[model samples]
Target chain A: MKKWSLITLVGADQAGIVAQVTQILAADDCELGETSMVRMGGSFSMMLRVRHDDMDLGALLKGICESLNLHLHVDEDVASNCEETDPDVNITVYGADRSGIVAEVTAILADAGLNIIDLETAVAGTADKPIYIMTIEGQALQGVDALTEAAKKISKGIELNIVPIQTLRA
Target chain B: MTVLDILQYPDERLKQSSKTVEIFDQTLKDFVTDLEETRLAGPGAVGIAAPQVGCARRLVIVDVSQLKKPVDNHGYLLLINPEITKWQGMEKGREGCLSVPDYTGNVIRAESIRIRFQNIEGEWIEFDSGGYEARAIQHELDHLDGMLFLDRLVSRRSDLFTRKTYKK
Candidate 1:
């Protein structure tokens, strides 16, 4: 059995967060395969994906965050499970950039009982001309038309577009 | 009608810039035939480029009237040594590639576009289009630049993939 690893960082904008996180991540015999980091106003946020054959990474990450005086939380990854079932689908949300877009949209998805397998989100444009783009790959729950209905709700704040996973046939 | 053998990822020819045609010669005619034939043979086919058939040249053919899309467009359009001059509107779409088989990605594109291209007779012509027609134009033009739909993929989230369906 393979264990899942997640590394999350949050703290005042500073230099040592990565140096410290990598130290703990390395001890887990984990390999860092994916990462993204950014500075938002006065704080720094980072997300990373590592692989380990151990137990929950959430508890380990929480202790690290506490010792560093930063706020952090981690949860079990869901995308890996979804990938095992259907391997094709794309869902995205786009709109005016704003705070809590991820929280709000993720909440909506969870409430609808949809399983979010993989998600990538970013704020493009400028501070004065901001645009938000959030992409989630998942399957709709029973009695849910994930592509159209979810898009309509997300669009109330941001434009939404949904399409089936792409395939090339010759 | 010849169905194109889809080129796959990391094929060096796919990354090399395409060569521009100096004239609408015999080679150009052959490309049109191949492109058109490939378009017809594909399942839910709409358009194809010279490079998709393994020829790196400035030629492509498109016919989208059969698919469900935005507007009424020409039945079939064959273009040579083409170039786009202007466009309007902004849209993000999910586009797949014959070369990068079995995967789809998000692509931001123009809503309408003005373009110029030569016919098989060497007569150059220009036109304007919107909706699905514009998408076809952009798709074909990207082929001329040696670009596949994969380059425009914003993220891996939209990657719809299938088990290896086509071989070189």
Candidate 2:
């Protein structure tokens, strides 16, 4: 079976993390492709896309990740199986920070056969006047304004905005 | 005359400052028509700035009545030599450019604004607006000053794509 893998390294920040990660990838006979590493809020988060050969792939990867006290998720050849990115439709939701905001929106989009392509959510300002901002991308199954009117009703109590966005071609 | 083509980036016309709408005459009318036409010719465009159409004039046209925001918008206003008199609220939003097609960037601007501008007839008009209408006016006005929404972006932190939604 052809194996295309995505390895995510998320844990506490420390030295040798990157080196250890590369070592693990090399040992797994995987070809490393693109990578993004960030240290924020006192935690190190790194993600890499890789292609791996067969022979005890999943269990082997789990062992290495467990030893390092990290969580690892491996998807085999998913990109080659389905390489197309989800079409993005930009939508904004903001209100007083509260629970279930993401679930409410995602559920509505989910019901409409739309996938949450990407999401950026933040709670800003002090706790007294905390502001919640969520920017999301979802794929439209049919056409324009398909989810808009329904969103308008669900969005009344909350501030919702939608705009079509096309990302940079890389 | 024909509708002026909306100049894309890397074009020198887009980099230069637009001329002021000195006289709101037939020539100016043609420019406004071209701006509207160019705006209509593309994907749903909320606004256009004069510099985008190769005219370095401080003129812009905006209409966000079609947006889903709940607020008052004055339909389409052909602004010649417009100015912002009052502004409030702060927001970081995702914005796209008619000049720079196929890319959307993040931009932050005042949430509301009171603006003064000259109509196509050279008569002065003023407006107090908020929500998407206010955002469209700000985006268009930025064009009047040789600015693209890209210039206002805080960072590449957020990009808008209708289809390619996120970094995976």
Candidate 3:
């Protein structure tokens, strides 16, 4: 049986954060899989899945945190057997930065029987007139029409481009 | 002219290399009409290939004139046994295919190209195409050799984007 663990780390944005963390993982002879890292605001965040040889995970976390000046959280019981389906579509929302954008959109998707697989958002421009861009990729549970109508109900001043995913591959 | 059914992805027929057209008969002409009708029927479709419609012939149709984006393009083109003779400059362009409708990806293609092809009348014609027109043509031509934008993704993790929905 494979022992899979999930780990999350966050730290103030700086150069070489990725190198330092990766070097530590390499030193431990651990296998890293399914990872995502991003810079949000003034901080950097990372989430990763790993398989280690029954090492002291608590001590490893402390060493990583102290050396990289970051915080670490780990869950040892993550199930690795679940299979994920590809998303049915990709929704991109662009408008003025404001609260509730993700909440409202995710609520609509959830209600329409859509499962969000991945999401990324960023705010650009200025503090006074920031541009909020959100991309949500997920699988549709029902049909395409239901999701389109739900997306259409979003507030004005926001531009939504809905593209139907080709379920076929070449 | 009737709109032909487009072959979706994972169809073995789409992966087969198309045969070059040697005879310009009425059957070929009729196929072109159906191809044009099918392309027009697709939402925002500017070009299409024969393999997309399950035909293994070297044929494609392109017209970028009506798009909202102002592009340096020739009005309408019907290419038969088309071949790119020369190409220059490289740039990344976002593209979605009618056959591969669900995803869009950034593909690196030549910014400008010189191509030779047979028109509807079976006359070999050559032209210098650039910008969006060039990109569209390259995408359709890739189908002749059984290639999709997914196969040309600059980076599978970063360049590929799932399309939301196409609204009229």
Candidates' C-alpha lDDT = 0.67, 0.70, 0.80
lDDT of 2 by residue, B80-104 (tens): 8889999998765567776776666
Task: State how far residue B23 of model 1 sits from its true place (Å).
Answer: 6.0
List the candidates ranked by lDDT, beginning with the highest. Answer: 3, 2, 1
TM-score of chain B of 1: 0.83
Q: In model 1 chain A, which range of ten residues has the least summed lDDT?
A: A78-87
Q: Give lDDT tens digits, candidate 1, residues A25-85.
A: 7887767765777767678888876777657676666776877777766645524331233
Q: Which pairs in model 1 have colliding backbones?
A: A79-A117, A168-B102
Once model 3 is optimally superposed onto the true structure by TM-score, how far is the C-alpha of residue B129 displaced, in angstroms? Answer: 15
- List the lowest-lDDT window of 10 residues for candidate 3 chain B: B156-165
Q: What is every candidate's C-alpha DockQ against the true complex, given to 2 decimals?
A: 0.08, 0.05, 0.11
For model 2, the stretches where C-alpha displacement exceeds 4 angstroms are A1-37, A40-43, A46-114, A119-170, B66-71, B154-168
Per-prediction TM-score to the true structure, in the order listed: 0.58, 0.58, 0.58
lDDT over C-alpha atoms for residue B11 of model 1:
77
Q: What is the per-residue lDDT of model 3 for residues B73-140, given as tens digits with 9 covering 90 to 100?
A: 89989999999999998865567777776566657888799999998778999999997789889988
